[model samples]
Target: MDRVPILKIGDILLVSIQIDMEDQVALQLQEDLAERIVATGCHGVVIDISALDIVDSFVGRTLATIASISRVLDAETVVVGMRPAVAITLVELGLSLPGIRTALNVELGMELLARARDEGVNEDGDAEDEPGTPAVPAP
Candidate 1:
């Protein structure tokens, strides 16, 4: 029943969870988020799960899968708004997400994303225009 909504802010796609947290929903999360990530071609993904009371293996796996596919889709996925207890439980459960990024909060996560995008641009030294930074570029 709980479905997350994906919002966009400055090349970052922010997804906030609705708390259903069912296995079926978990699978949908991977597919839907992956599609959005590929469609937007954004630099970062912020997933808010503060409302989630529990994160079992299914949800954890779904998140990891989303992160993995997001990378292939050219976007970085960082799970934000995870409570301390939830994080601790996830760690204890032996679900180690290798490539996925985690942030304690949304603001911090966005900062991390900004830094990543900047680093990528600077590395190339192309001085190309940045993506999703307030002004909507012409298509």
Candidate 2:
């Protein structure tokens, strides 16, 4: 029944997962995140998983589902702070997380999200120009 907190920073939603997540908790998070994205009209989501040492296949799929849902809602999702062993395990398990974006840490994740937003692009680097808002020209 533990619920992860979702904080808003500018146009991004920050979720720092500090505990070992249960399956139900992960599902709840996905639901809550979708709700938050709709309620806040946020442009991005940064999930900090630095504290999680193990990410099983279920958890990996849940994360991917969350990212896909966020993208459909017009919010990009960035997962950060994966342990090295977890990365290797995920690859070995054939869970490459094809559509989920990632970063080494929260700072870098935030920067990535910000740059994507400023450039009017989605996490996939696709142009998502908002009406009446000019896209920042690439340098």
Candidate 3:
């Protein structure tokens, strides 16, 4: 089985999927990513799927699961490089891919992740403020 390479860029992990996603490969990726997030303590995850022309329901679900896992680990996930046909196929397959944010390309995806990190919010919507720090400023 071919394992997807997960590279670390500053505080973010970049996953560029260049191979066909089989069931085992997808599951392995999920496991590997979770471990990497914990090991690296990265605050963001950018998954570039531009090379993939098709995304099946299982792959969609796997992506969602990966995002959820990343959120739980205090990292944000952004999927990038989705073709129009793939989007339509996902919709037709009835997979909305909840909890997955997308960007047009790797650069945009990294920007989105960086913005989310700057906002101090994880993918789970939790604020990453210091202890006793107010979420909003006083009048």
Candidate 4:
């Protein structure tokens, strides 16, 4: 079984899927990602799928599940590097992946994560305050 490696960069977890993922692999990835987020105290997750040429319903749901799980852990999830064909196929297949944040590439994904973290908001729109950080007063 091939396991997806999750890299911790500062406060972000980066996952680059470079192969065609089977259902079991995707499930394993979901589990591994959640564990990594909790273990590393990461504030964001960026999944790069640029190399994946196809995404079926199972894969799509797995991605969504990962995103949702990350959010519940107070970590933002940004799925980047979605190919144009994959996007169209997902839409056509009725897999819109609601509540999952996306970016064109890793650079933009990192920026989004940084902005969200700086604003004290998680991917699920919940407000979070970093310890020892001064809270901003509401205008």
Candidate 1 lDDT over residue span 1-139, tens digit each: 5566789897999988867777777777777788787787787999888988888887777788888888788787888898889888988998766677888899999988888877876865643454534555799
State the lDDT of candidate 3 residue by residue for 12-110, as single tens digits.
899999888888998999999999999999989999988889999878888998999999999999999998999999899898787799999988888
TM-score of each: 0.78, 0.82, 0.83, 0.83
The C-alpha lDDT values of all candidates are 0.81, 0.88, 0.89, 0.89
lDDT per residue as tens, model 2, 13-33: 999998777888888899999
Evaluation by TM-score, superior candidate among 1 and 3: 3
Model 3, global lDDT: 0.89
RMSD of 4: 6.3
lDDT over C-alpha atoms for residue 16 of model 2? 92
RMSD of each: 7.6, 6.9, 5.7, 6.3
lDDT of 3 at 115: 86
**Which residue pairs overlap in candidate 1's backbone?**
10-132
